[model samples]
Target: MLSFPSRKHSSLRVALTALTTLAVAGGAAAIPTTSTATPNAAPKSWDETAYRGQVEVVRTPEGPADTEYLTGRVFVDQDRDSASDRRERGLDGVVVSNGRDVVTTDRHGRYRLPAYDNMTVFITQPAGYQVPVDESNVAQFHYNHLPEGSPELRYGGIAPTGPLPDAVNFPLVRSQLTRAQEQHCVIAGDLQTYDRTEVEYARQGAINDLAGRRDYQGCGTLFIGDVVGDDLSLYPDVKDLTSLTNGPARFLPGNHDLDFDSATAEHAFDTFRAQMAPAYYSYDVGDVHIVALNTVRYPCTPDVDNADGRRPECDDPENSPRYNGRLDENQLAWLEQDLAAVDDDKLVVVAGHIPLLTFADEGSAIHQVDQVREVYELLEGREAVSVAGHTHSIENMRTGDLVQGWQDLFGVEGLPFPHITAGAISGDWYSGELTENGYPVAVGRDGGRPGLLTLDIRGDSFRERYTVTGESDRVQTQLGINSPTYRDWYAERQAWNDNPEGAAPELGDPHVVIREDLAGQTWLTTNFWMGSTGSTVEVEIDGRRAGEATRTQEMRGEDQLIGPEWSDPHAVAQQLVHGGSVADRTMHLWRFELPADLGTGRHRAEVTATDAHGREYTDVLHFRVVDQP
Candidate 1:
């Protein structure tokens, strides 16, 4: 039997010990040293211990006589071994797939699917049970069968599998953790590590935080694309990072993860399928159903009139090939079939690499999915939410939220369900200055911090929250003052950037505002990372109640609001001085106009931001009303 250590006291010793000391000193009843909670406990944390095993591939004296079809069994492995024993019982009615066709196990947990070349056979993990994981904590449920390996490429693709086996058996163990109604699903985006240094940076930042937490184990962590930055060789090191996590790690294919050297789109993600996971798949946990999709169409041809403009680069595929955000016909057909098999009562979570629609690149057709309307029609009248990661920005777009580009290009007037663009793990390509924690302070293009999104699911509903890397949940919003003086300084800085000058002039003080500047127009801006249509922001100046702030980019069929007036000053100050993507536009920035007739003195502004779920986060900003610069 394989034994794994518990993570209960691994990272929370200091904090837990402090709480224990307080209880003992107060003379109250002592807290239990170990967990003694029941299976029905309201709040249950994962213990970080799981049965480490692999799939059992049974072989006979000779291979199976039948070569037309592949067969597999889903059984309960009571002995903790990968092989199935006589006493081990087969689990019936479990879902299995051969990339396109979905099937269920028979009475004896045996399933037969059509066999084909380059087909990936996998099973959708049923609720209340968990498939065995490898040493790296990666869910080992799929079998990649490529009779003939990938074509000649720069990166070594999948090695050819000789022939069909007798029987491929899948082992699963009972887990009460997944059966629980409350679950935390981690949606991480764009861990696009280009080299070894960025991998280490990821280790210190999000990976370190995940190592300390034990909340997400049942639902596991899903890395939605961009696993590596166009370098397929780093897949092993990336898997090593997942080994430190407390849950089963899964991945999706992104543009950067493509085999660019491949001659066709059929083999573009062959290496990814061998190392990570299938191009697209679906699974169930609790009352939620997650569908992972491969939305990147590589080496796209100009024959398809999907994009708004022509891509001259894709004219000659033999020479140059470009990737566009569009799903192929087969995957789209499979998606409809996959959803038809799912129960209507379950919450459908559609996850992909590129977003179906995004506020970051709202005007660019290639950046957003081409057949978005078709996807929406398929999920009509069903409880669904879309989560993606490719824009490297955090966007929490609610239902009925509309953008002009969506209307112009896809004819989408309002969103049918919530669409969240979980910010990138490698924020701004790991640009900007390095922090003391050994990781770069890689603020995103939307002026949002690099973080992971957690969908706290309870029954058929869910609440979303974003946790900044290496920071507590309380750190939700960034506060800054946008004034006329700052706008002038912004223009001066931009012009100086175009032409080389002796020394760049800095905005004397962003927090200080003159009377004339206030007379023109001054507003206190709040960059709430997860704020959406239903969210509200209120400001109070020096204990005086100010009016509620207005969101700059109201997703009401309007064009994108750009320029310094709408920019996040707090993020711009850092990006302009150091180096990174500018935060000139976003969908989550709120502004409250300051009183133009204020006195010349230092003042305090307290901002309280409330999300759609009624969760509130408060932050304070201090600025001076100056007479002159």
Candidate 2:
């Protein structure tokens, strides 16, 4: 495990002027004859002053002719038409452009630039005009195009782009801070907008949420990544969506935040750093140290002779991908140094795009590292909790031998720390038709509502709430077994629906429910999605607190396909895909004898679950404690 000696780093400087110089050609392109037309045609010498918003453009792999540019005009909605009327003037000096080729709006608030196809174009948002933040703290802004038809990409979803409109306009309303808006936040997952239309889809799916809100008080928002699918150019339009927001917006990088342009670690995240911030960094907010870590790696080439002896692949960039985890010497050192400076007792919340521990393909090369255990060990006994996204599923594995079941794949074992897979706010790639809010009603693997997690950290203890779409403070504790016996039944059902000829085996007695025959010795392990290490599961018998369960194990390992050697056709079918089952029937979880004194007619007892984030959930079980005949 790496460690940093404690020390204080300088406080981060607050941003002053929002406007940054507009980026011009790196290597000049011939001034377009259309732009250079009549004497009165073009504004004199790039007027630099009348402009008020932002514009970003990128040079694609193609030569200059094929290059694309996205220009935008941000207007003040004096009459609230949503569109800029002739009399309405555009905002001036607004910062615009993709992160790299930035430019400011002129005195006319009109800005234009050369960008590439599928590139993002947006504004930096002047102080007066608030930007939007998605549920994951991503900002709302403009992208250059949304092609009408689908483009060729692995994840197809962006809306199509029509003829370049006269101007991609952004409108801002006067700001007010309403209570609900005061603490408002927007969450988005791998907007992964591969093309212009997808960028537009992202725009449509997210912009409506920003209309006329005030509560955020401009605290801003944070977007956990997989931002523009894999296309880094779309970041600008991603920025534009934030312009509609009522607060400041921030971002954290995910695996997708890479520069395919570069081939080594040095340039691996260079594109991301150029577009966002240092991969892993932190900020302070009301007694909390929010530390974000960059855990992804750009696989490198093999090293000669496996020189370092640290690991044969550490030296070989080519071998890194097979490992799928990273934190370089610099980052590891910086992390220790970063943690060293914080007051030991200050509440620290670490955020990353990939989870430290997860149930999805645990043994797969894509999971977090064995070294992560050391990172967790460093935070031992500290008032800390780690949060992450990227799995695209909602899972709260609070405890149970982090590496116990799945470590062998990575050659690791043991509980490292408390981690939470915050689940994607976009929910299965925003799966559905677009909503008026400019987003889709994307839900997750478990059919839970699409939402985000909000943490109200009060000292060492924090309260977290998962706000679902169209639902308030909804939390799901039980995944509710998909049923082992119905494994083949569900398979058949799915197959039949897909293709009758290829139908799976007949559905057995799929309706029979199985209850725990906890003859006082059975243990139940519940994964309250997003549960962290310090969280607790309490049992109540007959409305009385039976005992508080200790979180002693971690759930990180490869799947063990063998069950109770379940060969019975009906039984095996039910347990097949549920992923939940009885284990050992004796260890870790506990089943205790019901107190004989509990004279039972109809007894109702509740199970209370409290997470490290302070979110509580209660479920009641009804039964009768009657005398045996």
Candidate 3:
């Protein structure tokens, strides 16, 4: 995974000032001109899944007289109109881009870039300035420069621009909400609703949770990639879902949200750019500057050499149509410039679709960023953290948490900052049985419940919390046990569930255990969904102090210990039969050895989990130690 966003070949930052009345939705009238170039058309058949070079970049000849120069001004919109007027002062030092090369606005607040057939000219909404939002509350900060709209596109790609406008201007409104150091930024992972029906499920799930709340209206809600599942048409439904939020909604594209039919990597996210949001962008709210990135490179090159760890080469993109975590060069340069402008006192929050590194699937080369150290170096002295989706798991990796996978794959020693996998809102791709609220249980691979991540920011410091969909924040850990009966049920159910050849066998009372079972290798398990290396779990059985349970996956350069032994049996009880990803091995599982000498009776085990930050949460589970069969 690469830490930066995406890069396009087109971008210009020049300064010019022009006055014109803007239209609704922050769009402007076209500059009167006739194009002297032939039409630049999309191919009849373009394979977006192929490597970058495989697809051809088709362009038409631009006559010397037909050359287009894009003109735009960055002005302080005294009136929040979408256009620049005499009354508005052109803001100096604001950065703008033609999609690739970046430039700052001149004293006149005007910029001119060599316009391409298809490009998106946008500004890096400067700190203390707010951008305009359309009907769905998506920030309208860029001008789509497609002279002729998309061809053979599904999601109604950018509308055809008859000609290049005389100027494209940006508007900004000043707000105290964005100036405060304390900000509540909501980072929602993979709202990947495949169709209309799942869209409604989302409406009832996290969207419902956001509607009645009022915290994140300033820093806003960022849907960190996977906005849809291959269906570009569903972008509207995703937008409608965002309308429920009290804040502005932003988006990033994921592998599944790609325009796979597009011929080249440059236009792979065109439909998404047209419908959902920019491929990548940065905005600031209060003392926090958020750098939202697009990190998925589809149809990644596969490496067949390093099978089963004899170790050499690591470029597996998982066959055709799959993707890996990566970023192009342009974004990295823009990021450097963006960060250089910010004061050291400000907090930086970097978000992307794919994580730079994660505890789940730690050893998989494709699961973590290939350029994590570069990102770490970029933010060397700044207080920053990264949050991402795509793994369908929740991981709260703190600084200094080491895994051999990162060391081996990317030569990364340890994390430079907290790297959190936000645990997709489309948990397990919206799997499992439907809840009473009409949404799926969607338990994640690490057994994290479907939820949203909130970063409670105060100046440069922040606290992160996950609120499970349809459940309160208190639902942090899942309790389970391992015994002969549990293991037997686990094996039997997984088999029948996979094949479905017979009536599914029901698991007996999962929370209950017998003295005989305890004698025969019964162990209590606590799956602390967000637990990390420093976290601890302890148990008190029936008023007596039991020893502390040891955490699995010590995260110190060790290989994965998977299978039934490390599984969360409570999750397996449902997952083996349901549709979600199985919760087999977890980095946060704590196993307590059950005492073989316990008397035959009902016993209560009090479980306490202490997070890396010293915050403790407790829960109790009751199980019987009976003499029954």
Winning model by TM-score: 1
Superposed model 1: Cα runs more than 4 Å off? 1-48, 304-313
Tally clashing residue pairs in candidate 3: 13
lDDT of 1 by residue, 145-213 (tens): 887788887887778876876778889998876776677889999999999999999999999988877
Looking at candidate 2, the ten consecutive residues that score lowest on lDDT are 25-34
List, residue by residue over 1-629, the lDDT tens digit for candidate 3. 10122223222322322211111110011111222111122222112111111101113344233356666677776655465678888877766766665666777776656668877777777666767766676777777778777776566666785566656777776655567655778899988889898898889999999875666666778999888888888887887887666666888888888877654466678788877677887887876778888787655544422343422233443334455677766667667766765667667898998888877767776666666778888899777989999888888888877877788787888788888888888898988899999999888788777899888776667767777787655666778888888888778888887788868877778877866788788888888877887888888999996579988778777777788888888887778777778888777789998999888878888887777655676777888877885
Evaluate all candidate structures by whole-model CA lDDT and list the values in order: 0.83, 0.48, 0.72
Worst 10 residues of 1 by lDDT: 19-28
Best candidate (score: lDDT): 1
Supply the global lDDT for candidate 2: 0.48
- lDDT tens per residue, model 2, 1-629: 11113434344322212223342210011121111111111122211211223222222344234225555577775665455676888787555554234455667777666644433455544433444333323434555344452333223334454544445666654433211111222333445566777666555544443333333333344566676677777777777766565455567777676765444554455455544544565544444556667766656333522233433444545433423455656567656545554556556677777666555445444455435666876676566766777766655544344544345544446544345555555555666545566656554443333455555443344544454443324343432222333343554554554565653465433322233222332222333444555656776766586676543333434353322211122212332322222221111121223344555355554556665544466654454433331
TM-score between candidate 1 and the true structure: 0.91
Pairwise lDDT winner, candidates 1 and 2 = 1
Per-candidate TM-scores read 0.91, 0.53, 0.84
